[model samples]
Target: MSEVPPRAATAAALLIDALRRAGVRYLFANFGSDHPAIIEALAADRERGLQAPAVVLCPHEYVALSAAHGYAAVTGEPQAVLVHTDVGTANLGGAVHNAARARVPVFVFAGLTPFTLEGELPGGRNTHINHLQDTADQHALVRQYVKWSYDIRTGRNVPQLVGRALQLATSAPAGPVYLTGAREVLAEEVPVPEVAADRWGPVARVPAPEAVVDELIADLQAARAPLVVTSYLGRTQSSVDKLVAVAERLGVPVVEYNAEVLSFPHDHALHLGDDPHPFVAAADVVLALDTDVPWIAASAQPPAGAKVYVVNEDPLQESIPLWYLPADHHVRADSGLVLDQILDRLPAGEDPRAARRAAEAAAAGRRIRAEHERAAAADMAAGRLTPATVARVIAGLVDEETIVLNEAISVAPEVWKHLPRTLPGTLYGNRGTSLGWSGGGALGIKLAAPDSTVVAIVGDGTFYFSVPSATYWIAQRYGLPVLTVVLDNGGWNATKRNLRRQYDGGAADRTDRYWVNLQQSADFPGIAAAAGQARGTTVTRFEDLEDALRAGLDDVAAGVPAVVSVRLDPISHQAEDPV
Candidate 1:
């Protein structure tokens, strides 16, 4: 091991040391002119055989941020991200939104222009682009999305500032945090402060109050019809077990709305359907656990006299500007901790109607499962390859060791319906409605859990947004073999549906509308083949779907990334009214 450097070391070295002490393993970065000092520092540290975070070079800013998002989501720990000053930061807007919405802790760092115009130190005002890129308020670009933003003006304060940023980012309602450093400041010498390895201790999860737990228990025992709704309940594997145990013990049904992660076992008896509208409408008491939008109020509302209780780290959803969910009691605490407390405070005996309620919920779950199977069979019988059929086929091929990352917006309902996720950390999706998150996120997930098979299911429109060439190249270079399945529906199906919903029987509702159509689909398989390190295949017939998926999975198992594209029929399910 390399000895500790002198106190008068570059600020970048101190920053790197602080990050390493904070348990950061990887640094996802996109290099640029402004990053020379930090780059040199990292190179020097490696040359001396000092322990430092391994750097992963990303082809684009979005890929870098999204990769960090994926790693954090899987490990429940923040990773570092470095980008160029202005243009690079702008490219991360969409990715930052996804991280914030998912509540993933990410430490974002960017290089700023030199503070001194004249040559005062190394890496100070070397190029004309530096002057052109410098801005008075670079932090403003990402302030709205991050939990905290700061400018490291002095080299001596780098360690303290970085420590604080990590603390805030991993605290309650964890999210991304941003920090900017000027070239001159980073190159300057600074005194190394005596900081502990775990300077910022693990984030303290706030538990629900005794009174709140008692009240919730009383309501659960009294209510004849109760429901539990959650979106991100399975942040950790232990949390998933706790949530399931609490719901089963109380005989309450759980409905996962726009689920981004597998919170409860899909095959469990107390597990209600994914659609929360019907359950919310009929529930006498609703327990919302980390759900942002439980139900669409315009389409379905809870009973007028229903007692709605919400338990989340951030009950208000501070990232969203205008959030108005009806709740009778708002307990600001960690969802997993609250569930544990509720379970601990349970009364001696079960509810009088617990057995009956459990049986009814189980029956409802069976009906929902049957309906999904029938719909898939009907679609197959009609000789049309539907998303549900594809999902079921894929689900049948993989086991608990496979991880599925989904960015299939229009086909999500089918994906959720057919693919039953029982293992924790087996499913992930875009929580922020971003198009390209899954592809890059899969790479990060694979890096975090290299032993598991990582598969990404994306739509044609979302596939292009994923920058497939860059993602696949990174996979091949890093020896990360991920299986990517493209659901090619010819055009932007979601956009067309939205347009028709708003402009039905109007001029814009015509099929020939220019903005609604994504003409000339590319051969995704061909693009993947061009990467030289990956194999690609295309399936046009439903009979070939299973075989193609199996072949792709085989390639992944052999340490080779593969892409399988399925040309789907351009049928709009949204055109029909809801049943």
Candidate 2:
């Protein structure tokens, strides 16, 4: 005879059970008093030996949401967040957009006043909530951005409904889910089901269609000067290994497209940087996998007779110039699945060109490295805040697990070289040109991997404009800590460079837009401590660098999100104001 669980479990208990069944092990929470019933239920679970929720306190809703995004995206397990009422959701709106754009799966839970429970004074202060009692309308605000949103209605239906929500959140094209629980429903009793054991970790095998593989083999076998371009496929560890294998078999070049992140190690000889225009123009055949196609051939000018092949699930139909480049063929399916197909078809015989081409790429990679070093050394000698040194020091601090969420446009390449990634450890900045995305993303990464230290390497311009106020919540409130390493070089280095390049030898600082160039020296560490009582430090001496990095990581690991501000000399290339 089996014992059935009690019917006295509250909505919180039911919801928590659903998450546990789905293999949820951690929460990135920022609490509020929008509803007492839900709060009390969580408290009761903690008391009754259900195990205290492993919660990471974050500084702001943006940070909380961003951390959740990173955790879910990398781990391939859905992350959880508890947003307050309307105000809290509004504050987190930008970060929510960032996650939605990334297609990362997370559950954004919020509490709205129950229509039945509010006395005469339900809508205390949430202006967006109609009254103290509200409908599920407020919860739907995230629908355009998140995959799904729901308000838990009755207690009796909860245990099952929660499971459905989990399914939707972790499904393919994974994105965030928004759920609301009425205060009264959260208090009501329900028959509890035993927590379902985790049956999913991350789905790794994507079986390629054999028919497609045959066609691809025929197409690839004909390519004279073939090239491989990769995108978001870096989501899985197998991605790098698979892509590397496929490229090597053909003795072809593998380039990372819009490679805002380290898709393949820069050290690989085959890895031509993202802008393969130079090589693509000459390539007899170019294959793009999981990339936004237009970006690979948008200039309306590819080399004559170059054939372009695409492999992706969704062949984007809107505003995409499909005919601009000579379309050789299209395989509409998952990227990993397609790669698996190609691997199966690779011939067993050794490729003579493989060694030679790889050697050439390796040599080229070394030359590029030397050029970068000379440029960095020049900037270091210029006595301005160079982004290179700041990136170098920060990159050296991260191990294989650490993630760097960077938003500096001018110094991205230098940063990539200084701290190249092992497979699947790094995430790129947003592809949409959204500036503040990295600050929120760093927070999201921390929430997702609570045990792993996350660092947001921001440019001085980005920190001052977006992240300066973002850390208050993490440092002062919910205790989830992430170190923000600000690369302060005093101005918009990238923008000025672009402007100077566009205009021949123009005096950029002539207008010197004082706003673009800060007129006053900022006391960054002092400002950081004041914003959220974050332990702050200024790194000026190379001798004191390692210790500062260790201290920051330790504090963040201990749940005290801190900021390390480094002031570097500007790269000397901007002396004439490239902008």
Candidate 3:
């Protein structure tokens, strides 16, 4: 970066430098045979003391991609990921889907098989495995999920192309982008182009139009019962603040359906519980702000003639093939900016009607809280280690500053009920139905916010899906101490529950043939213990739950990754004749 003229360098080194120039700080990488050129470039850069993004070696593709997703969720800054060829891309699997659904920007690059044959070029194919790995279309694996996919043909424009990829990824309605390159091109040395900083920037927020402002204002002011619903608006702290002001000013109760972050303080008078069904049914006006599915129309819908306003960065959800939500008005702009506009246009004086609505909502909130508390108490009295009790115990162990990642699939509602998230950036959940994102997500969150306590609550099935060995290994190696609570219910409870719900009188249900059951004994604690320098423990009885959870927290506080497996009742099965 001195005044001297730039020199030629390997495409790999230049690409790394490109990421650094683009403000990428870390590269979560899982290497393979195709990455030799990249490895050599990294080594050469190190020898010359040139700056580049820090490479965090990941053993599995799922963890690598999920870690990048988690980091972006907290910081709102896309990170970089490097994986192997098609095989590694296949392994990315559901984690990439999770990233796409969450709208987290990430730069994902993979190595492609060498195009040259034996002895033909410096970085030509050298192994039989290379022949097996080559695909006619490598990007086809994830092309449907990513915003953009490209194969880098030449090294001349590597930096500029990388900048463009990142710019597209970070723009509004952000998501991951894919890039792949062969070894020969990556090893080709070329003069680094003078990078232009201004050309590859993200598009700024598009403000809401003023023409429909008066109509929206009139509807909001006239409605007797208005409601607001959101999912990921809380991803940005300022957005959460703006939403709170606007909702409180209008006395509109807010509900979070499948929320990925804590958008509103749970204790607020206008903060309704997660389910939007009951409120949506009675409301005359509804504002669906930054939510994909405001309500399942079959289960719940607004009154026949309700005034519905759909507002988001992408109100139509163009990425999704079929998004048929009802909307009277569609505002395609930044949700936070729209909230700011609404707050500014409202009258300064408080309305008597708005105050009365707030008071009624407070009563409704109290009822909901009491109902949940009673349910938890009843479960405790049943002498079982229920999800409610597990959630309550974990809730007691964490404070407002702790970063909690919830992937307790069937029992997620219980977790949400017991653990009230009061602050922004304190809680996250996967918007996608991926089973194991939270394991690596906890690591990424810790990496981004090192001072915060990170706790990940995962189901027994999700724990297995998360590739615990790889996740915990990264945690131990990187000095990221995270407390993972495994809610062991013995099997895939969500899948089994759905089966029973749909086939109550069917032969499979009558025979108690729940094929999804994982009846085998699993020592989840031992799995954690296998990771070097990590602590593992188990709790079965309700009485011992608190102590075990506290001990795990203590271990994490002392700088060791810990796993506490809390065993709930196993899935019930009818006795079968001896095989």
Candidate 4:
């Protein structure tokens, strides 16, 4: 008979080994009383020279999940995150929501309170805190946000449970998955199964059907004006190139709306500005690729006689409860695969009107860009650092290798106007509208793209929400340096605008309206200095913005984290109007 192979002495050891073998490079962790066994197992593995997924200690659960989210966004590989019991899992809800919306793969693991009070297992309850920490349904904390959730039932089920979670996370319509590790289960000894590393890798991406491709091509061929609108198309460099090729070849105008990733070359002749409403209203054939809200229905919609095609791996966007975008043709397949197939099948030569369309689009794009620049200049000359000017100066400073993470909602459209991202993986934003994602997301991007400069452009309101002290300490502790630029508008400007638009001259119009003002701004630079790992600077003058930004960028390039807080003007009533 064949001799039995060795097995991991503890369930936690087997779980860690399984994750490492599954291509996870890092495990962001926030420990608690329930994590002792897993922590010990990790230390033991390190001592045994079996490290692959290095453990990164995070100060908070939100940071851990956000870091994991950012890492997955850049690497295109699912990463692991370990959190404490109920409270830690509760803190992860927002970040998990962001990951779910972004469709980034994250494997989240949380420890459960001990199952026994009499020490039936190696790590069973020894203190009263265990009983208090135990919840009736801990997994429910993140159940709705994740693609799948499980509580490990037995020590022997660790390998299968973990493997299943990873598989679900990396599968089509990828998102986060959660698994709770019972303290007793983690400590119990069981024979580890010999699960193959590739046993549960991402399922193969199937191309779109030939009939759908042909119909799409036929529509493109027949249409006088074609437009492509996307939000999260540029997951890979090849996808970006392929989409660009298809648009240029077909003479289609591409608009990226609320783009979380750089979907197209902004400088391309056929590339339209960020807003899709105008183009969507004009195009005869509208191809919406991977965009959730192609156009706000109340404010804008496709022309009455236009045909719309919506393509995505998950056509319905199941994560979102109330998505009501209209589409005539909903092709459910991998976006990159569909684009590649379209490129392969498109007619050899350009249409008769291709040149004219291209020229007209190019001219319009130039006009739009110029208008934005003029508006920015006007705003700056008025003695305030406009969002556009700040974005433009930063755009001038950054190269193709820089990665920009933006969560400044009010000024994001303005920033995109100045910073024409031409490279894939060079831009990311909050698709889920989470306030504190950028600060932690920037750190994750820096970890994944250590050679590239990572910058987090956030608002003053967002800066406060980001848990600045914890984020900075994590950066310093892990040696991940990212330039953090705070667009200080003195308050929740977006909220203020909404109130004015919704209430008009009602109670909200009063200057003393409750919870609207954040008039007393904190010294952000001083806050950074207190962290001991980051340096900070505050720029109040428009003329000083450039120098301050350059200095902060220099500091980041020198392997130190830096913050540049630029005082922005109040939201202009005419902010949304064209120049």
Candidate closer to the true structure by lDDT (higher is better), 1 or 2: 1
Task: List, residue by residue over 1-579, the lDDT tens digit for candidate 4.
Answer: 211127546778778877877778888988899888788888877677767788888888887888888888898888899988998898885888898888899999999988878856677888888888889999778888889998877777677787888888988888999888878888878886777767777788878889988988888877877888999898766799889888787777899999999999888877888988887788899998988888888777878889899898888877678886677878888888998899888777657776777778888788888898789778767756778888888988889768888888888888888777888999998787678988778888889999999988888888887778778888988989888888887778788778888887777475436354555358887786677368878898878888888899888888889999887664432222255
Q: Tell me, by TM-score, which candidate is best.
A: 3
Q: Which ten residues in a row have the lowest lDDT in candidate 2?
A: 117-126
How do the residues 1-579 of candidate 2 rate in per-residue lDDT, one tens digit apiece?
221236467767677656655667666676766656656656666666565355666557776776676666667777678877676787676677767666677878887765552353332333434364354467656767777777787767665666666677666556788888756567667776554434433333345468757766665566656677776777765677777777777666776766545567666767766556666666666777766653544543346777677775444532233434346666566777777778877778876666565666566557766777787677656544456766666666777767777676677666765666665666566553445666556655665566777787777777765555655555455555778777777777777776766764556545554235642268766776777677878877656666887788888777777777776664333223365
* Residue-level lDDT tens digits of model 3 in 120-173: 877898899989999999999999899999988888899888988999999998
TM per candidate: 0.96, 0.81, 0.97, 0.95
Model 1: per-residue Cα lDDT over 388-413, one tens digit each? 88888899999976899878897887
Best by lDDT: 3
Worst 10 residues of 1 by lDDT: 570-579
The segments of candidate 2 whose C-alpha lies over 4 angstroms from its true place after superposition are 1-5, 116-140, 190-206, 293-301, 317-327, 353-360, 381-384, 394-402, 426-454, 464-482, 491-510, 513-520, 531-534, 539-562, 568-579
- Clashing residue pairs in candidate 4 (N, C-alpha, C atoms within 3 angstroms): none
Report lDDT per candidate.
0.84, 0.65, 0.87, 0.83
Q: Give Cα distance to truth, residue 262, candidate 3, Å.
A: 0.6
Clashing pairs in 1: none
Give the candidate order by descending lDDT: 3, 1, 4, 2
